[model samples]
Target: MNGEDAIRAVDSLFASVKNADIRQKLGKPHTNAGEILPAGVDSLINSIGDIDDQDIFLDVGCGLGNVLVQFALQTLVSKCYGIEVREEVLIHGLQLMDETPSLRDYCGKVAIVCAEASTIQLAFERPYLTSKRQGLSQ
Candidate 1:
């Protein structure tokens, strides 16, 4: 999709999600919300080098799922997770993946949750331990 088309797609996706009731039910709006620019996303992903199928990428507080979507489309990572406190936003992200043909490749690869980041217990499937322990000299 071109710039206009992408914008239109995003706009339509947002239009389709009616978060009014969800927001009202919450009683207060989320304060931790924002999206990384496409350029920044690109740079960040590119710097990550290669992504294996077993590797899972996690984005905390992923608003609108922009970063997750970008990562799924731009990289070969088969699994991606986004922890979002808002349900409607995650729904909107899923809706976007369904609507955009370019994102078809990532259908079952993306997962978004409506929960706090700190509440998540699993850090990584396999803990990546460093030789030198923090605050302890070897």
Candidate 2:
């Protein structure tokens, strides 16, 4: 989608989500300061380092799921775990994925939760020492 189309899609998605607090947080215009990385938000995805083809990546405070989408498209993060506190933003991200075919495929490999970042835990399916050695080899 083009810029205008993307904007309209986001606007429409925002309209469908009903949480007041979430709406307030997302409805306002956003700045590209700390919300996005210095090298561009996609760079953050690249910084996650190597994992096996099946390892899951966790994105804390994933606002509109842009970083998650970028990683899903361009990297081998395998699965993405996005923690978003705002219900409206989460809904918008989900709806956007539902409406876009490529995004839908990306979403298939992702799990999103609406929750506080501090409370989210990262549990390893395998032991960290083994995973770290494997990640290094990759």
Candidate 3:
């Protein structure tokens, strides 16, 4: 999809969640994962080792594309996909992507979808990044 379409897809997903209001009233941060990931999360993501261009990385419960964006920035993975159920979070990430001049270039490389974590598809049946794969750890 084009840049605007990518942006709108995220926006529409957020619109759906805002209309639902399930997580909004909980006082949780709308789109960021700062609450769940401890400090140095970005550093940890950057430190991941040995990912290649043919690998398709999936960010499960990817919130606002922070981790996914980081992944794309740090590595040369063939594709990076994120599945987040909340439209607000996905839209929020899209907004961030649109705002960041450098990240905006990655719109074509990264894909975000609004869907349940359990229902999301993965490129592999198992984790692509794990201790077993060394630098591929996620």
Candidate 4:
């Protein structure tokens, strides 16, 4: 699918889940549980330039995996990881991924982890970053 089509698909999937339900699930009086809209996703993809299949994308504080899903649909990034602290929201996001038929192919590439972003240590290394560091050392 193209960028616009991918954005529309993601937007529709996210729209299926109501904000009220998210707020209720969160049960926080003052929580900033907002997602990047389609426009923002478009702008983000543009700003990020080119994404290769070997590139890994990490979305810190990825709420509902919207951006991750979008990236999977819109880009060639092989692995997309979303770190979220709230288990409740993470559960919802996982359910969305599982239940959405369109996401079946991309789901394998996406992983939503329930953990504090700052404390989590990702095991995988980015090939581009590693090569860049090697070049610097040489």
For TM-score, the strongest prediction is 4
Give the per-residue lDDT digits (tens) of candidate 2, residues 48-84.
Answer: 5554566667778777676566555555667888888
* Residue 2 of model 3, lDDT score: 33
Model 2 poorest 10 in a row by lDDT:
30-39
Point out the higher-scoring one by lDDT: 1 or 4: 4
Model 3: ten consecutive residues of lowest lDDT: 32-41
Give the runs in model 2 whose Cα sits over 4 Å from its true position.
Answer: 1-34, 37-39, 45-52, 124-127, 132-138
Global CA lDDT of candidate 2, please? 0.59
Cα lDDT tens digits for candidate 3, 47-120: 66566777777877776765566556556667888888778757877776776564565555789989877674
**6-58 per-residue lDDT for model 1 (tens digits):** 34444443454444523435557556644556667776866766666656788
**lDDT of each prediction vs. the true structure?**
0.64, 0.59, 0.59, 0.80
Task: Identify the superior model by TM-score, candidate 1 or candidate 3.
Answer: 1
Top-lDDT candidate index = 4
The window of 10 residues in a row where model 1 has the poorest summed lDDT is 1-10
Comparison by TM-score, 2 against 3, better one: 2
- For candidate 4, the lDDT comes to 0.80
Q: Quote each prediction's TM-score.
A: 0.67, 0.61, 0.59, 0.82
